[model samples]
Target: MELFFFQLLNGLGLGVIYFLLSVGLTITFGLLNFVNFAHGAFYMVGAYVTFVIVSLTGNFWLALLIAPLVIGTLAIALEQSVVKFSYVLEHKYQILVTLGVALMLQELVIMIWGPIGKNVSPPSSLAGIIEIGDFIYPKYRAFVIAFSALIAIVVWWGLEKTKFGALVRAGSENAQMVGLLGVNITRLFSITFGLGGLLAGLAGVLAAPLRGADPFMGVEALGIAFIVVVIGGMGSFLGALVGGLVVGVMQSVMSSVWPEGASLMVYAAMAAVILSRPRGLFGRA
Candidate 1:
């Protein structure tokens, strides 16, 4: 029972990170009707940026602050320069262009950082374990959970309360109408794309301390993000949150119950969800 509880907590922590990863993808889709296959590359670059900052400054906190901004700017630039052109194209062309962009960024990372993975130590303040009777947990993991939950709340509030959020929601429903009303839909699309990149970058920075920064990690993260999106329903914020938690808890618990099949179980859960609700848990039919 103790082990189960421990795994469950770990899973919750992981779920939030997954939420951070996929929310941007979903939001971009929701607002722009565009899918960014290069999002994982943006994530990968964020991790690498963290690695560089921490290595030079020995300050994990600084990396946390700057890396996301860097990736967000880069994403905005990409959108303005190249990605925007593909928006009017079919989904297949969008996929191809973004996939090409992803490949280019991946190679750029390899060229600059080399193929070797680098470990990021948790900040000195969080570099310890918490003990409560027989239960033990990493301090950093706890921080991740608390911090990510805070972010989730802020994001939810922003989306629910802000005028920008209103525009995004309205744009998703009828972008042409929003444009007709003088919303500057192009600028909004750029901002939305940037926001998505920022979130993915944040997720990468948080995850670096846990999994280390690797060139190929983005590919893996991308796959997991897509799975979360599929399970939760594309373009649904609530779905991203619930799907992340479900996937995270299942994977974490399965690691203890069936170590070798943990990865397989993730797919199994997704399959089950799809069989029952093809539109996803919170997605609109």
Candidate 2:
């Protein structure tokens, strides 16, 4: 029973991270109809930026506040200058361009931060263990789960209840119609792109303490995020949430029982989900 509870809590923490990592990717796809393979690059940049900021200011809170903004602004610039051109291109072209961009960004990170990885310690306030009814867990991990959940709630509210979200959803179905309705889709696209970047960046910061800052971390996370997105259903916010938790918990349990096949379990789950529901658990046709 103790082991079960431990694994469940740990799984929830991992799920929250996956959720943060993939939500932005789904939003971009759902609203803008753009495939951005470079989203994970933003995640890498966010972690590196957080490391740099923390090193300079000795304040995790400051890094938390600024790193996402930096990445978000950079994403906005990229959308305006480069990605905008790919918007009208075929899906293959978009994939090629974004993959190229992702490679370039990875190389850039290596040049700036070196090939070595860096570690980040949790904030002093959160760097302790908490005990509850004979079950002990790290405070930082709990914080990660709670903080990510809070963000998830905010995102849900923003998208499901806000006017901008409605516009985005409507645009996803018929962009031409939304444009005809005088919605200024170009601006909307930019905002949505930046928002996605911001979410990825935030994920990076939250993950730095757990996974460390590595140039290849983005690539690794990108694969898992893709799986989560696929499992949850492309463009479905609820899908992302449910898929993330499911994958996270599955991986956690597998790691304990069959450490060697832990990674394979997520893929297996993805295959099963895909086979049963082509559109994903929460995805639309």
Candidate 3:
């Protein structure tokens, strides 16, 4: 029972990270009708940036603040220069071009930081364990769960309640109609992309200490993220949240009980979900 509880906490933490990146992909795809394979690259960059900031300033808070801003600003530039043009092309072109961009970004990371990975230790304040009667839990892991839950709530509120959120939703449903209604869709896309990068960047920052700041970490995340997106419903925000948690818990349990079968279990769960629901568990039909 103790093990199960711990796994649940770990799953929640992992789910949040997955949620962060998938949400952006969901919005970008659902709204702009563009395929962005490079989103994971931004996530990788965020971890590296967080590592650098933590090394220089020795301040976790500062790293959190700066990492998202830097990545988001870069995303703004990326959208303006290339992503903007890709919208006119087919999804295949968008995927191919974005994959190229992802490779370029990965290489750029290697050149700047060399061929090794970096690690950022959790803040001094968050280190160690907390005793809860019979079970002791890591404080950092708890923070991961709480932080992710807060972010999920904020994203949900923004999309469901705010005026701008309504605009984004309308555009996603029918961009031509939204644009004709005087909503600036191009600008909105740019903003959404940047915000998406911000979320990915924040994920990087959070995952840095857990997974270490590796150049290839983004590559690792991409697979799981794609699965979560598929299982949760490709364009559904709530789907991403539930899917992430489901995948995370499944991975955690499988890894514990059948380490050798861990990787296969992830795909098995995804396959099961897909087989059961072709449009996704929460996606529109």
Which 10-residue span in candidate 2 carries the lowest summed lDDT?
1-10
Instruction: Identify the candidate with maximal lDDT.
Output: 1
* TM-score per candidate, chains pooled: 0.98, 0.98, 0.98
lDDT of 1 by residue, 138-240 (tens): 9999999999999999989988899999998898889999999988999999999999999999999999999999889889989999999999998889999
TM-score of 1: 0.98
lDDT of each: 0.93, 0.91, 0.88
Pairs clashing in candidate 2? none
lDDT of 2 by residue, 178-210 (tens): 999888989999999999999999999999998
By TM-score, the better pick of 1 and 3 is 1
Candidate 3 per-residue lDDT over residues 1-285, each given as its tens digit = 899888878888888889997888888888888888998998999999999989998998898889989999999999999878889999999998888888899999999998799989899999999898999999988888898899899999999999978988888889999999888888999998998889989999999989888778778877777888889987789999988888888788777888899779888888997899987889877
